[model samples]
Target: MKNIIGAKLKAYRAKNGVSQFDLALKSKGKLSTSTTSTAETVTNYDPRLSTFIEMYRYVDTPFDELLTEMGYGESYQSTWYKRHKGNS
Candidate 1:
């Protein structure tokens, strides 16, 4: 895998004018500058579930839009919600 999520996150960061440092700061220890950089540039990056959530949440990226862009259909989205709901 080529880290599709990270690429989309980079695009979102650029679109929203948010720097890595800013994202890390905004995350309040949920994220870090190094982690953000690695996520954007590392081909083998495997981020945690919370990392994915916080990154997208920081840039206000819509979950449905991201899933669609990543080639996951609406079915998977609903399945994900069903499985993960109330866990957090």
Candidate 2:
């Protein structure tokens, strides 16, 4: 799982044309470069929830889509997205 997510994160960063240091600075400490490196190297998989969200924002990807790709249940959007995004 860590390997999968790490690869995805590295891909996303590449797609956005940014390095890990740039990403961490852009996130304004919402996510750390160390954590980003961890995610990329398969050394750390459990990034903070806030860091995960920041990744979505940084990559210009929708959070719902990310959640789906993460293998969240089909009912997740219906059950959690609205509440999580304060749309409820």
Question: Per-residue lDDT for 85 in model 2?
Answer: 70
**CA error at residue 19 for candidate 2, angstroms:** 1.1
What is the per-residue lDDT of model 1 for residues 1-88, given as tens digits with 9 covering 90 to 100?
3366778768878998888887777789788888888988998787888888877775445666666666675566667687885697
Query: Number of the top candidate by TM-score?
Result: 1
State each model's CA lDDT, in order.
0.75, 0.67
User: Candidate 2: which stretches are off by over 4 Å?
Assistant: 1-5, 77-88
- For all predicted structures, in order, the TM-scores are 0.67, 0.66
Cα lDDT tens digits for candidate 2, 1-88: 2334566668878887888888778888776788888878865477777766666665544555566666764565674556667554
The 10-residue segment of model 2 with minimum total lDDT is 1-10
lDDT score for candidate 1 against the true structure: 0.75
